[model samples]
Target: MTSIPKTSRRDFLKLAAAAGGGLVLGFHWESAEAKIMNVIHGGTVAGSDISFNSYLSISPDDVITIFSPNPELGQNIKTSFPMIVAEELDADWTKVHVQQAMLDTKKYERQVTGGSGAIPHSWERLRKAGATARYMLMEAAAKRWSVPASSLTAEHGVVYHKESGRKATYGELATDASAIAVPADVKLKDKKDFKLIGTAVRNVDSKQMITGKPLYGLDFYREGMLFAMLQRPPAFGTKIKSVDAAAAKAMPGIVDVVTFKNNVAVVGKSTWQVNKARKALKVEYEPDGAAALESTTDHDQIFKKLLDSSDPNVVSVKRKDGDADAAFKTAAKVITKEYQCPFLSHSPLEPMNFFAHVRPDGVELVGPSQTPDMARNETAKLLNIPPEQITLELTRLGGGFGRRLKADYVLEAAELSSLIKAPVKVIWTREDDMTGGSYRPAVRYRFSAALDAKGNLVGYKLRGVGINAGNCTREDNFPSGAVDNLQIESIEHKSPITTGAWRAPITNFLAFAEQAFIDEVAMAAGKDPVAFRLDLLAKAKTTPVGAIKYDIDRMKGVIDLVVEKSQWGKKKGVSQGFSVYFSHRSYVAQVAEIEMKKGKPVLEKIHAAADCGVVVNISGANQQVRGGVTDGLGHALFGSLTFKDGAAEQKNFNNYRLIRMKEVPAIDVHFVNNGIDPTGLGEPALPPTGGAVANALFKALGKRLYNQPFTKQEELKGVSLGERL
Candidate 1:
């Protein structure tokens, strides 16, 4: 059971008086402190000076509107977030309305939604918002009936006096409730009493989404809005030298052409017209000052050099425990392997786009942004306007996968709008979206493990090399805490190629590298992969080394569950592989079942066990886990983004591969309901999937794959869902 700290009744009364003495029934809660007060009365807002710090509003007619403060990047936070508030409020599910709140730092904390943080960040505050409103309703009923507030119980949007057989709907008491003193503290429902959280609720926007409703940033429209398409440098480390837009401006439907920074923008009445004109524009490029013009070949050679280099300038120790050198010296066997994954394009279904209306007095911005607060701040800095003068609204994002975290596209729209003195919607074509340099950094990991003559693991070492990846090693994750002697180091090459977070960030590929290497070591030790991992976990639980950031129990729980669900060793004719990872404070374990068909490995199914604390909207949670697994598997199988002379070789889907329906394996998702606060679900399941599949592939192929895009290998090339032999 959880309890919310109360704001004293006396303090709330003082706040009401300060807000002109009307009924103010909500508290502006921030990081365990109720700093301000706000209220709405009879469906009209009452406090202008007050920051609406709460997530919900109750009006006459008992309608409750819950505001989802974070961006919905196809993660279903739009539905699940409000479900949490409604559950705590004990409000009727049918009567709850959810709205996407605009960017307001004071009203909502942590408006950014990347890193699977939306639920974990806002969980307690949303629950308290509901409880507070429920408390107010009960107080209003107590005042009307001349009874003690404690004598009335609130449930399902009603205040009831059981002893007297009296009841009042929240709608009937809303007006009076708005005037009641805000409660300082309220009791939260225990986990056993959760009514809506564990249940599967369909996406709130499913109906609108399926019926072709205009909901995404691409669907956004304004009466006089102009469409824009930009021509950026053809390759990384290049900038615009000169532009010839006369031919583009002569095209029909093309309103104007402009240049800003390194981009040339063609603004027109429609996307089609702008795209046609954009192709007509002639632009010259020059090498950017001091930025290296690199290619995939260059990066490959660089990674190899850095992995071998001992220069302190190239390698930085991320974590070091007992001397690894001594442990390896006494070991009977040493297993060394190198794993590589290429830079990847986010390739969201909806390409990058945003709408900006920059006016003299204020700015009206609307689009799909995973970090609206960051976008707003960056836009303010670019436009030389106060942040307060900007109003940003969020639209349903088609997909993000961490690409929207950057405000580059948002700034593009704002800059064009400001220059043209009109509202503009900046749209990136599929070619632009893919070739644009904000890619997942190409990374390589070298792992060496030492085992004693008795077959017990003694030492582990990792050296990571990456292009523009700030920190490539997850120093504290897994084997770090379990191993006796461990050393993790990172080597970075600052390429001119831009890179940023993609899904689970470094863990997306690192988990695979670490787990695959662990599997190899287990094989060398003649131990079952599952049993080997469990033994290490047990050792860590009993006597951990250094600092352990992950919850051992949670990780073990998922591993056990996946083993049971996948029937690990019981299923014949199928090669089985196991992997578990902890990220974003959530644990996920996956088992991939593979079978050789027509001399190639075909992934048959994946069984996944996730411990994301208490499940909120089980349907959405299942989809998230399954989607992450599929994404990870597809990328590992056939995704690669290579550069030739700093130009991305793959421009669109034709060359850049994605999983097809036939190739996607069936996935079973199971969640552990430990009745704890929800952690992130968006990225946790993704990290372990690649490792699981690769381990399974090893079992089926009798060989190890050391690089991603397993298709790159001569034998695995064109591997797909081949028919069973």
Candidate 2:
């Protein structure tokens, strides 16, 4: 059971003996939140007690505490999610305190963050939660005033009796409010009535960040903790034959050099000591087959290979419209283009780290993890403890971009500490973090289309190859089935490297490539790209993206809104090209102006627009929009991770360049100002940027760029032309 404090800027502390001596409770709401008057109950969402801690909480002090289950990796959900509930709670924005909800899946299940689905998925549930609490408080006040519920009105955390001019604050009714059963169907406010939502709000935690409060995993601290760094294989499929730990064991602060699982780990009093000892320790091993992996696979080659190859196991076909094959066969003119994007890394500012205290009965984990649900299960497996005994304490993330979802590092920490018989924290150096694996799987995409005798639209076809995304961001459970005629296939060039979710999952990369190709088709047909996309959306919405893809109408609505905002088909610069893409239930369109100077592409400006249904925490949503766009720009310019003789060639930022301040052109973001519940604006904004830039580049150069390492053609020198674009 939880209790709300009666004073402003206070806290609700739970002090149960954790089944047998667990964590202590201490929390405080900042003074700024004392004026909040919203009553928001977390339970009764979809009629379940399991998710009570998910959306929002209230204290007797009038402080509104909003729960954001997902990790805050500088994307600003800390502010966005709260603004959503605040809109319905009628809580004064000045009195709201956004809380970092723990990684308790049983309490706030589905806390894992990725797919840009955080806010959109939680929108209705959170709003409904707030609305229900308001109803409960209103009922309590209505009874006290002996007035009809209809006659009593609530605003800004206060319930008022209009006729009598009497009022009771939501906090004053908190005690009585808790005793009542939740109304069967709490009434929600109409969209037009919203105040906080659909409005740009500043980030709730920005001040804390600028002030250097302990927010991310990098700032995590524990009493008497030992640090460890794992020694991974130099290449995939290789194992250490033996290790020389003599030098490491003698080093100061070096606790022990031990082997866990297949890798050697050096433990120390500090990260620097552990890292220093790791370098001093030497090992030899038998390398894997990927040792011969090369950066030589050019764009055109792999794209064609994916098309002509017959390796099945294509798990999904997301979308297809009309008789594509027949249209292509009968067309008067046919143009086929191929595209390729190399592997990428999440490379979050804070590299992966985890703190674990392993006891005989169970384990406790502290640090940042996107999926606490998965963490519980995986930690249970590694610790050989009951799933119930494992407790996960999630902290704020420096960054994720889909990397923290995997619980490998958490398990590793627990396993190492359990053996050492002490609390331990595992830290990855920038080098270890990069080489440790689980990167975005590189992909090859091929697109083809046909134009009729009249040059009207006839058909579209797509073939994708390389590592399958099913290995990571599996959407088999999505509302819509996978693609159609879409022919999404894969061939695994398995390496020792592990791969997991990155950004919007594998479908998004395909969307970026496939959508850009479709844009080209529309241009070849002399049809407006926006209108052409709408036609496809109409078919997909009515039909479906094969079995399941996503909400088609919602997707189209966003795209349409973007076109209206971005002035689709209007030329900013005749040489600039534009494209649009949809992912995670959001649509984004970008028109990039580019110029070819001495064979180098220079982007001049970008106009971006999106429809996320509703806008929550305007500042945070806009930040994500801008950040995701810039992330795409960096990738389009020079970000490409390739393998050579089974080793990743691009070691760090020097070679794997990100978009710097100088490269970022003027980016303009506009939203569909509707308070129709909240939707997210993270990864959805990224998928379209590359395609838009590529399309723009084509418009400027009069030739298509269908390969990655955009300018690293030398790597593909000896590679087969079919495998190199």
Candidate 1, residue 260: lDDT: 89
Task: Tell me, by lDDT, which candidate is best.
Answer: 1
| 1-725: candidate 2 lDDT, tens digit per residue | 01111111123222111111111111112111111132233321112222234434455566565556677677776676667667776776776776666665455645767777777666666666677777777878888888888898888888899899998876677656755566656677887777776566766666767888777677787889899999987765676788889999999999998886678999999989888899998888775544433333542354465457664453335444445677777888787876667778788888989999998777888888888778878888876778889777767788888888888888889889889998999988777777675788777666676777865555555555655344322223222232232323334444345677888777546655665677777777787766666665665566565454456656555566656655655764445567666677676777777654455556767778787776766666777888888887776666777776556777777777676687787788877664455556778888778778767666666656666645554433332321111
Judged by lDDT against the true structure, how good is candidate 1?
0.84
What's the lDDT for all of these models? 0.84, 0.66
Error of 1 at 193 (Å): 0.5
Candidate 1: 10-residue stretch with minimal lDDT: 1-10
CA displacement after TM-score superposition, residue 613 of candidate 1 (Å): 0.6
Assess every candidate by TM-score. Answer: 0.94, 0.84
The TM-score obtained by model 1 is 0.94
* Clash pairs for candidate 1: 6-184, 6-185, 7-184
